[model samples]
Target: MSVPKLLIFILLIFGSSTAFAQHEEEKFDAAGTILHHILDTHDWHITDIPTGTDAEGHATYTPIALHLPWFFYSSRDGFTFASGTESLLEKGYVPYHEGLYPLKAGVSVAEHMDDHGHLEIHMEEEAFKEAYVDEAVTVIDLSLTKTSLQMILIGLLLLFVFRGVAKAYQRREGQAPKGFQGAMEVVIIFIRDEVARPYLGDKAMVFLPYLLTLFFFIWFANLFGLMPFNSNIAGNISVTSALAVLTFIIIQVNGTKDYWRHIFNTPGVPWWLKFGIPIMPIVEVIGIFTKPFALAVRLFANITAGHFMVLGLVSLIFIMSNAGENVAGGLGIMPISVLFSLVIFALEMIVAIVQPFIFTLLTAVFVGMAMESHDDHH
Candidate 1:
């Protein structure tokens, strides 16, 4: 056949196949849109494309997404491998009722019939909890999620950068810093002098490696999240909590005799207070976990909240403009959305720097507290 006819034939085959591939995606309500942007999922959602009607004559929109692998291993199943979420669904899961189990296939989760005659399960409810609580939890998700991907990227970026700097240092032995090395030297010196020294004292050098890594890693992760279509790494509580746990572990492991004594014994407190009250040591012990908890929550909240605000502002454009389908509305809303988003984006960048500093500084302070002598406290 001719080129034009062949092209037409190919289009007809594929175009008809995708007709019921999707439905007109539900409109993004403010809260849902904001949450969706902040929350982690199994795939990278790029955009949606319109398709023909479904059997029920509903307008369809096909999602264009990059899927991540799903890894689940159970004793019964040995190890199940699915290249993507769709594959997982085809393997066993059907519509995801609870705990990766198919609806009506096993555990019953509460469902309700909607006005449109559809069964809806509120996954946020007690039914989900009930379904999961007794279920044999055999699957371990080793899959790389969006957050996982971002973290790996951040780690590789840090590795590539500092490795180059390390080599630069070796090459330049006694010479002056140059290029990226010089720029990084300034930041490194700033961290060592400003953040680590004041708090960690002479032990600043001892803790500098971790403190420097924490600061730069966090800062990098925050900035990475700010990029368009990137996962919100800093905003993920799991990621932040893991970072805080590292600091906690390091602080505890490296804690001086003075630190343990300060926790258990009364240095300056009265005997009665130590024995009878027991509040001081209890408070001190609790403070250890609480400080790290605060670090995690603060970073997570600040980054997540900023992202939510930015997403909200951007979503406002779509809400008003409807992707230029409404020209008058688009013109009216575009400038407002852009202006506010830019302002928040700027603030978020500052926050990106400030939060990492705060985490590192507080970590230094906690370490110093643990290392400080009784004489030092006074």
Candidate 2:
């Protein structure tokens, strides 16, 4: 064959093989499948059971199960159980559960219990009391849960980094900052001069700790979420909601007497107008609550939406290839998908920094509004 023909043949073979491989991988690449595996299964530590019998010996040697950081098992049809034999027959393989009972090739007979097992039963009950109370539902998986761990880790990291910086400064005792200390000093000053001073003025120092911590903590969490193995804790609604509530509380607690009086009882308004102005106060109160709600939703939605979009784009390749005839079409779309992924990745970097800034800025604005004094110059 000529060089051109050989090249064409090679391309055809490579393309055909890649298509087949991708088709197989696509089964596990569905929207939530990869995420579920990562969140639930990846680095999952499973304890092994002993296979061999002990000294008195029904079976002299039992199979010993060891804990593994990673293991793969299909949950498609669900797990199984067996009687006496320690063999589990699933997908034509005899797999051991907990390294002991060989799961029989069938549906699991074991009843699923909630994390707490407060409501333990085989079947659902109609009566209120009999109904599975699902204690597990309320019992949060603190270790497995993303938000708690993220917050704890972020807080610790901030303290460590800040502490280190402080120590470095103390050692230098006024000399120019070096290395990490210098970098952090620059960032701290920038935030103080650019972010805090401009917004909060001299009183900005009062909120400096909170503002700095909030900015860096959020920025770190956002960046962490973008890491391959890290969880999207800030993207979680509950976490964002808590942060929003904190901001709301601060705004309310720090509100000046003038602020409250203006909302509850407008000073200059005529008596008849003030008495009739029931709707304004209601709207004003609603607005107060809505501000924090918007803050929470904005941060949560933006972070979550970015992840979903990236996942969706990657999923498109699988969906199209699974359609069979669209091999060429899918191949054609790969570059576009990759391009968009790169773009989004870059955008995410900006968002990582920008989101915390926006959050802090809005927080300061809200605080300023609440503490605004008529006596002070505009």
- Cα-based lDDT for every prediction: 0.75, 0.62
TM-score, candidate 2, is 0.65
Question: Residue-wise lDDT of candidate 2 within 301-351, one digit each (tens)?
Answer: 677656655665665666566655568868977888888877878888898
In candidate 2 the C-alpha lDDT for residue 176 amounts to 91
Tell me the TM-score of each prediction against the true structure.
0.78, 0.65
lDDT of 1 by residue, 1-378 (tens): 235434533443344234313322433344445666777766788787988888889877777877777766654466777775446545644224313443234543323444443335556546654553334534555567778887888999999999999999999999999999999999999999999999888889989999999999999989989997788988989889999999899889878888888777758888777778888888888987998999898888788777766776776676566545676886788899899999989999999999999999999988887777776463
The positional error of residue 363 in candidate 1, measured at the CA in angstroms, is 1.2
Candidate 1 clashes between residue pairs 3 or more apart in a chain or in different chains: none
